[model samples]
Target: MQVLRWDGGGPMLATRDSSTLTVLIGTFAVLWLLWAIKKQRKAAVHPLPPGPRGLPIVGYLPFVGTELHTKFHQLCGIYGPIYKVWLGNKLSIVISSPSLVKEVVRDQDAIFSNRDTNIVGRTITYGGADIALSLNCPNWKMLRKIFVREMLSPTNLDITLALRREEVRKTIRNVYDKKGTHIDLGDLAFITVMNAIMNMLWGGTLRGEEGAKFGAEFKHIFAELVMILGKPNVSDLFPALARFDLQGIRRKAKRISETIDRVLDYAIDKQIKSLAKAKEEGTTKTEQKDFLQVLLELSEQDDGAPSMIMTQIKALVFLS
Candidate 1:
């Protein structure tokens, strides 16, 4: 039968290829197992806090519920105040003890100053360009100095007090006019605080009418942004799959970021044009300079102080 058959060696080639592939796969799996064992041994040398074991690949992701705080509390009860949780491939350590928290926040603050910003957070914050999300470095220190020493100085806060008062009064009047109607106090408080912040940022340039219109639009955008930020993202849990963006969180964040950038650009352009016109007319400016103006002027300074770029300015404006 074998002598009678001549199939051009097709079966033989297929068998050889299959054998080769099997060998390669077997080799890879053995190597992986050895690597895992080595890692476990190394970890044993400096053992981590005890916690529940998880399944392969997915880890404990499947077991976690939507009410994460409650789950964390239960885990704390079982594993003491500090324990590690494997959320997908990421290792998150829970710190529930008050003394441990104080030690991290006060005694070891500098060691833990850098933050691990998620994918969506980084996209919206211009790749961690702002002080809030950026890595702790010289640039971060510089931004903090600008924010605390310059923008939030006692004198600057005093000057912006009128802006805050105006917003509070406006909120109170609005509430009075809508007396007995259903009103969400949370939303009301957020709007009041946001409006005050907006005024303090650019009230010197934007007229009252313009500010009112812009504030409404900005509030809606800001609410959407907060909602997006609060949602748990799969990409954040498994960073290797971030490029795929299975949940589309990154796309939504990018769209919101673009909208905010456009708004900031409009305001910046208007301010630049107004400043130019003032210079051309030789008019003495009498209005209090807003945070935007101060940041711009500082950017132009040739002094030894660490200054900001346009990208940094926009990033700070959005987060501020």
Candidate 2:
């Protein structure tokens, strides 16, 4: 049997096949032209921050690697104090030197106050529910004010100082007990600070294995979120490629978010149930007049009136 070939051999290939090939080429050409036009339009609208040139699609993602701070610092040394870096479709301005940081953060705070909404931040902070991660808006402003007034105010601190003192004394006692043993000072200091913060936020101590587990999980989730946001994200650099979500960043963010939500929900539900019982019994006495109690009281007021809720309280707790 003779083998057929593209070359002029046997019967010539059909004219229809050549026409189909022509149509395919034309289609690809038109699509590419349209894409170029769209890209040009976007470029005209939002001029990208000035930075070192990068590869197409991936941008400077490969160059960033994992150590974001180190990579940014290195780039800053070469490109001066302020420079831009791309991760996939996203662009970020890196402020390295203290002078530049002061200029942007202190002087131009109004311009930079509104945070850039990133996929990672949105997921980890419960769709921007947390004050630290939320965008600058009316809700954020109100929450921030409440946080300052209710949690971090000078009067609140005065009330909480006794608790802080007790926690610190316990920490010192524990350190003294471990004097004979090989104690990790770093671990001890971390636990001390964490316990102080937790006690202030929850009006309780983080003791025993169960509390340890919660602390470990919370720390891991928080650290992961900070790491993800701090690093160069490809999705932010290239918005077009954001849908692809390479590196599974969005999935990881969602998983971390769910874990945080579970913890916060458990705490809030307990507080709400206790508050409901107290109201039903008509008891003016409270076992503990904690931040949660104050928030519940505020939430009971008219919706039109200024109020606070579990979400805002939880955000304040985290911020504290």
| Ten-residue stretch with the least lDDT total in model 1 | 1-10
RMSD of 2: 8.7
Q: Over the stretch 110-136, how does candidate 1's per-residue lDDT look in tens digits?
A: 888777888777987889999898887
Clashing pairs in 2: 87-234, 88-234, 88-238, 89-236, 89-237, 89-238, 89-239, 90-236, 90-237, 90-238
Residue-level lDDT of model 2, residues 193-248, one tens digit each, is 87666666555323346555766677777778778777656676666768999877
Kindly give the stretch of ten consecutive residues in candidate 2 with the minimal lDDT sum.
284-293
lDDT at 19 for candidate 1? Answer: 67
lDDT of each: 0.84, 0.71
Best by TM-score: 1
